[model samples]
Target chain A: MATTSEIQSNRDLFERVARRRRRQHAEQTVFTWLLRAAVLISILTTVGIVIILVSQSVGFFAEVSPWEFLTGTEWAPLFSPQKFGVLSLVGGTLLVAVIAGLVSLTLGLGSAIFLSEYAPERLRRVLKPILEVLAGIPTVVYGYFALTFVTPILQNIFGHDQVIVFNALSAGLVMGLMIMPMVSTLSEDAMVAVPRSLRDAAYALGATRFEVSTKVVIPAALSGIVASFILGVSRAIGETMIVKIAAGATPNLTLNPLESIQAMTAYIVQVSLGETPQGSLEYKTIFAVGLLLFVMTLAMNIVGRWVISRFRQQYE
Target chain B: MNKQESIINKRQKLHAIRVLRDRIFVVGFALAVVVGILGLAALLFDVLIDGLPFLNINFLSSYASRKAENSGILAPLAGTIWIVGMTALLTIPIGVGTAIYLEEFASKNRFNRLIELNIANLAGVPSVIYGLLGLAVFVQFLFNGSRSVTAGALTMTLLILPIVVIASQEAMKAVPSSYRDAAYAMGANRWQVVKAVVLPQALPGMMSGIILALSRAIGESAPILIISSLVWVTFIPTSPDSKFTVLPLQIFTWVSQPQHSFRGIAAAAIIVLLIVLLSMNGIAIWIRSKYQSRPDQ
Candidate 1:
């Protein structure tokens, strides 16, 4: 016992303790720097993007005041004497998006209810993959489908003279088809988050599947459903190629889906396509509109994310 | 006895109506699924019909046509590869690093919560806004009015970074806590464990996510639209500074032309683009299936 005690005391018991501390300090320092860089990068990206957009768009603001950009009825930002109307684009975008939103709201919510409340195990497995596949298809492919296939169908319905070669109806209809999966997917998540206890209680109260889904499930998942709607709107607002190709760039302020109208996204595409003298006000307007689009989508996302988070907290 | 019999009859009618309504709902759901399937099928069929008729070696090898007689998507294809490759390079390091920081090091605090929310918001921002950002910041400010492959690639990197970060974080979170505990018990430093164990295991998910992100980058039109001008660059880009054309931009230009035959070329180009997209998606699906441990299990 004496020998063991002496050996333990003599073996330089705390040797290299200072060295270990120094090593740890170095690592901590490195990690701190790395983390700071990451946080800085993200914030910098956001600030830099906003700053660059504002800087370029200043010219656009100088040439055409914010009120005019927001409220102009005619959208000929180019051509002789230039009519600078933002509403023309906004009107087209809203018409298409609203129609698409309605179509998806009906189709998507219905499917979500059925899948969550009514689907058997087998049907769910098959249907879920199909929905994923639907979301996976690229937007460009959707654009082509709109141009070649959906446009013809719209033409048939409206007859030859009524339908433009490319118009808003085809674009809106195709966009609805594209976004239905997103709505259904989000709404299903919301529906699934409803406590099973609630469902069981509803069943105890003699509620039928339709009644439970409509009243209980939907009410519980209302936040998610709202979120889905906003998300669908976000997709509609940002979509470009499909509308550009299917909905022609004639920025006439009209509610008729038969006629072609340019959207905000399409305006960016239209302006970018030609030689619009870089750094010119006309050129800068693209970024200004883009900033507006960004703000709109960002607001929509915040609302949507809030709804989703609240609904999620209510369940597992 | 008469009251009992009437009540029974009423209950039976209610059950019958409920059954009928359920059946109607089932039918409606089935109809919706069928319509969705047919819509996608119709689109694929069109791509096959128009493009498959001309999906040959000659189509892949040739340059685009000014007269619609001898146009190929060679330059665009090359540009697509270059931009996509460069974007992957840009996104992977930054994205994966960010995910690591958030998952392993970030303290659960308000600042972290803000960062998380900001990332989510960034993910949902429109792809075209990225194009505008690229135009103002990269094309003009950084490159000084240069519309090169680098501008497009840099733009796309920002565009896809949000997706990559989200996906990477999700995969990192999938790592079991027990593994970290085990490594700690074995006296491994945090960096050593993360580097030697966590990263290797999470790599497949990150790689698959990168592939999928690149697929989106390649197919993206809006940002590429503002970054790369629609010039007829017949030669492949040999450097970052060289002007280029991507598949989507090329397809857009051809589709919009006055000539009808150019439409066929656009369709062909689209088919090629679809193949790339589907292949990337396929790899992602495969990786997901491989890594999926039942959440409950």
Candidate 2:
């Protein structure tokens, strides 16, 4: 047979090309829609999650009065009267967060200072990766470490070896250690962002290196440092495994870290992890507790954003 | 003569005080550094001593029974794998897609800003809230409607979505504008620019993020708990709809048990989890270094 080139002219080629173009165009349109759908769905899922929590939590709040939810000490939702004050849970969460926050701040800030200002470059390089390892130690491992190892230490230290079997102090301390990496990393970045010119200026003014860091760099990176602290706090509040395993199941309102107390997260796990029947009042209690946590976290996020914005404005 | 002698004495005293202060500052800083390094060293040593001894084949094959138990982590290990696998499947697509939209498709505006704020806010939300969300949504609203493996995985996907989005977006932003310009100048459409030009460049970055997030999900217990994922499974979950266990939960159960053998198993589980987490971070960092060293677009 003759070659196709000989049989087909420019007119045939034009027609074929046009058809192919239409096909490609149609395919492109489909893909665009699909991509958009995926993006929309992700956003929707995030919003949908919030909506689900809010909706179910509203159902929970309608039953338990706001005052009861906020200030009530009793939390026996499965009891005859079903009293549901969440002070104990909140108190437990605060107890843990405070301990974790304090530990992370000191360790993280100190580590940050070492990396940013003091250590030689080689040492800093070595220390940074090791520090990151400390951070990335799975939270589960932290929980176990707290329960098996740290709790024993706490017991020994407090002269309570026989007492405080399931204490918040152990859980909180380990949680703090786990979050130290987050705090240090963020704070390190902020300190690194501080211009060298500022340090030189401080030195030129006869200020000590320590003075430069605390007075100049720290103040300059105030927002970043504060942001790290807030992030660490959020982490402590959200942390579950350590508290759930080490802190025990008792949700009593107390500031003492030596006692067994149930955090909001622990309660959610306790109720959901086969302790309570599905769809029962005991189960609904998790949603109620969750709502309070959600609100607190949400408020924190708003304030964090405001702080970040204020920093940006000042810097710019 | 009196004024001159007084001035000299005052200057010497001030200099001495300055030297003392510097000495104090150095010592204080030195102490902080030592304490921080020592703290991390102590924790790692403790975990290693407890865990390294029990990392045996039997430990990998057995399941929990009772206190000071003969149990190992076979069920939980398999469950962790399933959860991480499903989570990767759910999270990577959603996270990468979100990043693409924000970085390439959508322009900066109030709507986009709101989306940005929402995402940041979501990141700050407690992981347990995500658990509740997952519980209400994945466990109840969809699938088999229980605390099945699928619910736990999907819930973790939600838990990690924000971090993934942020990481992926950073990766996308690292790509040069020249790639986009060349594609557009060649008459390539927006979708083509993204699919062909942008995504290929961004693939490694996005993969790194997914790996990190998956590693995190594997160790996560709260959301799994809220989703009602099982704790004491004797058998491996062969299906997403089946009840599952995970490394974190296993470690938790073992630690909580009032038995020495169980604590040993928990330590071993932690060691395994740490290895997995570290390996993921290593890969991401290696890829990042490679990308950075290439310098030229």
Candidate 3:
């Protein structure tokens, strides 16, 4: 019914709208792809780390047998005999981790209990930030504290002859302090997630505060608490500066905390700090050690996350 | 009558014991907090006391020295600034973009969940392991065995990316869905809604997260220690590729020294580093509180 000129104008307007819509669709597609690329970079980083670790570690294991690297008691890769015993380093790492575990569990759990159960909201707000401040303090600063202050205190208490200047005890103690906030925060979250009805029921049954926290709340939050402890252990094992500075870098095969011991992280730092050329066995050895450290921590992290997720699923 | 009286006495005794035990537990718990606070206070006191004597303009301005008395933090301080700046530039875009994609664009599917899990795991990876990755990937492969500032910055970018992404995601999540719906109702596209409505609400949170991450990057020593082994750097870094050291590494170097005088200088450096970190954290806290309070109005 329209005139020819009017019909032609109408067709032109429809085409322009279609063109704009197409352009908008194209823009969105491009933007979405760009975002997808951004996400891919994170996955790529993990891939890169794995590739670098595995390829170079292959070079290391080529020269040093995997069996010897696993079972050897000596870790002096740069020494005359060139022993590649990783167990010594693992032993030292475990020793420090165990000590740190004890300290963190006792102190961190206590703090968690107090914060979740005992402290008033106002006090909790103040205290939690203060505790977190400890977590935020640089580990290198903690290393310095361990080397200078804590070591001296230990030496004074245990007698200067008993505690060496670079004992694992000081390093482990400071590492515990560094990791305490994590344990406390995670455990506190778990405890807070526990139903208030549980606490109310306990109170109604005439259970004392201590009994309720220990028997009712703790049992309920056990998985989460265990997760916290595992994560804390992983952290302690991966910790570098505190051990590098405070715990001596001598790879000794001993379970004694009072002795100077080298941790796996410290050995990595020691080698990296040195001018070891790229592709050298010494450099490659660090990669091998790194692989071990990575696998250990990754396993612990996975287990911890699984436990936490399981615990979360329970309440959900 | 005797048996009933005995039972009553026994019940009272049991109640008293429980009360005493509860009081002990309370005291013990209170003592735990005191111990943590006291430990922090002691560390602060020790550093301040040791480092305050050497914290002068000269200390800030001078470079490293063979003589402990003549040493300053100039070179390493400059290095820290360059690395952190480059790290921020590299991290903020990618991290925020990744966060945006995950929160707004990505389909809620198995693949996205896998990426999320990967990121969470990466966050738990040791900083030093990242150092190893940096040493291998950046320093060796990319730079051909050059421990340049660029390599260090890139390495640091990887180290903090997970954290920034996580934080930004949280911020974006905190933006109510209503904002998006309102924007969409007005004929805005998804991008437009996110750009205009969601971002404005999330910006303060994102900024705080970035600041906190930067503060962490500033304090990190292990990764840098492995990346930059040039301990005696006496000149300021002029470019990203310039061989450089950072404040934490410098502190590590000074602390490692057996010389009694280096400890004072190390403490001075610690004081400077602490001030930078604490100020950033304080700013972040302030911004978060400000934004949090505004919604009430």
Candidate 4:
């Protein structure tokens, strides 16, 4: 039954198919490696950021003690008799962030509640995209608005003598407005995810609309809402351009919202804008401050993400 | 009978109070929505009032001058184009590839989980921190202190990489598993199945996402400002290595001027920037709407 030529031809066919499969396997491996390399780039970016920040900060700390940098009440790295107390900068950053947090949380949660529970379907459809547009406007534009428009309005309200043109209130308020949509959208998504059956159960218990929304939906979505607020505050803390433009450059330790104060981000921008030579103490100050800023944001983000994941498991 | 009447009266009062509370909430929440709408309206109106008069062809074509009247956005506009274009070219391939690796090829292992977590963290990192990273790594280390367009684009690519990867992964995930199964069952290899089935289905989504990411890049200025601080750029960027200034930076520069005239031009630049962003968003929305209703799906 096995002729010699026929057997040879069968062998040739098998070899050809095997070769093609082998080639394809090789190609697949190559492609996968290429993609893996791409993934490595992102990993490298994080590593690179950490390394650069740490290394430059090492140079900075070699000259200035970490204790003085953290607990000292003044931040005048650019002036004569350089004081590296970072608390003043931290104070300014927190003051603005706190003001922004209050505004965004109130407006953002209110809007989210309205969008999820109160607005008609048609109105919600129109309103959500409009709200999202607020998030997309450049922060620089917000900076401009804060400086030119909002500052004058603040002056009108509080009197020109009380409200300096570069007061923290204007910057904080506009920055709050900038981040409000982020909270609204995320909170709305969480609210919308709350089961309809829960709302119906509340209705069956003779709960009013307000009762149902506050007692049922909001409670169900509370963790997600809190996560959104934390992330919003994180955003407010890291915001630069608006504060750089509207908030004054003086790194005051005072809690007064009407005074000129410099945020941490604004301080970095100020140093960068000036001709601080590379590899100098002044230049290294930005990285040290950046490292601090990064750590703060990273902590909040991790907590926010953890909260979201923990609560998300409930519905899932 | 008197006690029953009093109970009934109390029930009616409770219901009335609940109704009033509901009404109050509705009005209050409606006002919150109004605040968002009114804020956007006010911003647009303010910018238009200050900017519309200055938006002319001459303003678009001229370079910056000491006099605000003669200053133009020619250099910065061209620079923005160069930066955005180069950023797209660099980001798309790497971003898409990373998504494919994580979503398609990678096993559900610790490394992949770490990658995902890292990306999430990166997304939360402030834009300014990224600027510091860019200034140190790209401008100083890679480019040897040259604030070139490539440096800026590379920085922007890294800035938006997390967004693009997340988006592309979402797009790829949206592709029906049945398509991949059919292709695989037909003796197509993994790469072949992905190329012929998944990519075609995910292309439109990925495109729209990438467009939106690019729009974000266009609006971002902090990293660019850090990378290239040359504000009074007169010549258009002719190469990847040319020093550049972007529209946001130019607007910032103008707005910082002590003179009132510069503020007018800054508003004009803002209008141009907003129009560009709106058009990009329109295209993204159009792509999403057009391709979302496929016959096969």
lDDT of 1 by residue, A1-316 (tens): 5697788766655556657767976886687577567656666678777887788788788878888888889877787678788888888888888877877777788778777888898988888777667677767777878888888888898798999987888888888888888999999988888899999999899887777887798988898899999999888999998888889988878989999888899989889888899877788878888888888888888888877776564555
Q: Per-residue lDDT of B1-297 in model 1, one digit per residue for the tens?
A: 999999999999999999798778777866676677777788888878877766788878888868765788899999999999898888888888788888887888999878887788778888888888888788888999999999999899888888898888878787788888898898777776677778887887787888888888988888898788665768899999999999988888877787777777778888888888888898888888887765652
DockQ of each: 0.55, 0.58, 0.78, 0.80
State residue B110's C-alpha deviation in candidate 3, in Å. Answer: 1.2
Per-residue lDDT of model 3, residues B46-162, tens digit only: 999999999999999999998999999999899999999999999998999899999998889999999999999999898999999998888878899888999999999999999
Candidate lDDT scores, in order, read 0.83, 0.79, 0.92, 0.92
Pairs that collide in candidate 2 are none
Model 4 TM-score on a 0 to 1 scale: 0.98
lDDT of 3 by residue, A1-316 (tens): 9999999999999999889878877887788788788888899999988998899999999899999999999988888878999999999999999899888888899999999999999999999989999988998899999987999999988999888889999999988888888999999999999999889999999999999999999999988899999999999999899999999989998977899999999999999988777789998999899999999999999999999887673654
Candidate 1 backbone collisions, by pair: B63-B72, B65-B71
Instruction: Locate the minimum summed-lDDT window of 10 residues in model 4 chain B.
Output: B190-199
Q: Which residue pairs in candidate 3 collide?
A: none
Compared with the true structure, what per-residue lDDT tens digits does model 4 show for residues B1-297?
999999999999999999999999988888888887898898999899999998999999999999988889999999999999999999999999999989888899998999999998998899998899889988888889999999999999999999999999999999989989998999998888877888888999999999999999999988888999888999999999999999999999998888888999999999999999988988998899899898887
Worst 10 residues of 4 chain A by lDDT: A307-316
Looking at model 4, residue A58 earns an lDDT score of 96
Error of 2 at A90 (Å): 0.8
lDDT of 1: 0.83
Please report, as a residue range, the 10-residue window in candidate 2 chain B with the lowest summed lDDT: B28-37
What is the per-candidate TM-score for chain B? Answer: 0.94, 0.93, 0.98, 0.98
Q: Candidate 2: which stretches are off by over 4 Å?
A: A1-8, A11-21, A79-81, A161-163, A313-316, B30-33, B67-69
